[model samples]
Target: MSNSVPMTVEGHRRLQEELKTLIRVERPKVVQDIAEARSHGDLSENAEYDAAKERQGFVEGRIQELNDKIARAQVIDPATIKSDKIVFGATVTVFDVDTEKEATYQIVGEDEADIKHGKISITSPVGKALIGHQVDEEVRIVVPSGVRVYEITRISYT
Candidate 1:
């Protein structure tokens, strides 16, 4: 219920790295490109200037977004949290009730949710359903594909 965003320590580190790279490397490069493009004259006819301006806009927007997320982040270390029931930063293994397939996912922040990497956002449908659930409990999640039931097989803090 907190307004602060929950993110794993690794996710926070990654965001810090990206912010550093953008401010130290990309920002200056974009500024130089803009200046060089402007020197070519006729701003309306300059494609390089237009492209550079567009890239600058995107870069600035991303920088602001990263800064906000980092500032509001509540870094959670999974290894430090101990819980038998599923919670933020918990890694849960689930068995599909229909297909009988098993899958593992780590409940993470919105920015760290990469399904291919087995990380899901706590705000996600499945993540929300799994929260506070215990091992062997069945969870019903309504996803875009439709409703699916999963049985919690295991829960771990790390």
Candidate 2:
């Protein structure tokens, strides 16, 4: 069985915007660049032509990838998600048992996860460990630093 491609509504909108920009703006610009480069003659010796072709290929590939992802995306709004248990789109506050440090992270999709922003992908080790757990539950997750225990202090949708 294949896993669902879970994504927040915002993340999905971002992807859609990116796809639109690539198709409407970037694609046309690259095509124009290629045409202008071709006018220089001698395609084999033209550096601009080569660069433009490479860039065009890259843009097309990215567009295809984004389209595929959007097609399979399961957009979920955080505010609409209601559950006491930890799940995707849940903002969970965890207290480190060993370090006595508290940290909050929003469980997000792979495309939207930014560690610097305290957003973690649902597929991550800690996220996986927290899933299906409720507030006050102690979870032990195996990380590169070794096994660490964290108590879920709070869970919020927003």
Candidate 3:
């Protein structure tokens, strides 16, 4: 579909696992909970019934969301990619021009973006600036603090 979303292979697999768990475990448990709540007599004043219905709604909504995401996911494997220039799923080591420090980051899809883990979204300021650039290329990115420069020292797909 035109609305497809890029997702790393690992991220796609994790999503699939969550979906499976929801369907196999969460769904059945919610159903059982609702059934037990209904047996408590008088659904009008039963807090357990209300709570179970709310949980059911949440589970159903989450299931639909996960299904949609999985269906539209464009799984990309980083290990299979090869390029001289920066591209999605590329793990790049860089040197900060202003701070004289070094850091490494992986250009990844939005769903897999985790700055704490060194995985950045392709649409992020630094990621956008680094794309299509090769080693030793200086990339300038404007963030909330200020403009920061980075020199691409290395690029690896694995």
Q: What root-mean-square deviation over C-alphas does model 1 reach?
A: 1.5
Each model's lDDT comes to 0.94, 0.94, 0.92
Q: Say which candidate scores most in TM-score.
A: 1
- Cα misplacement distance, residue 112 of candidate 2 (Å): 0.6
TM-scores, all models, native as reference: 0.96, 0.95, 0.89
Lowest lDDT 10-mer window, candidate 3?
Answer: 1-10
Model 3 gets an lDDT of 0.92
Candidate 1, 120-148: lDDT as tens digits: 99999999999999998999999999999
How do the residues 1-158 of candidate 3 rate in per-residue lDDT, one tens digit apiece? 34988888988988899889999999999999999999999999999999999999999999998899888988889899889999888999999999999999999888789999999999999889999999999988899899999999999998
lDDT of 1 at 61: 94
Q: Predictions ranked by TM-score, top down?
A: 1, 2, 3
| Model 1 worst lDDT window (10 residues) | 1-10
Model 2, position 19: C-alpha lDDT score: 99
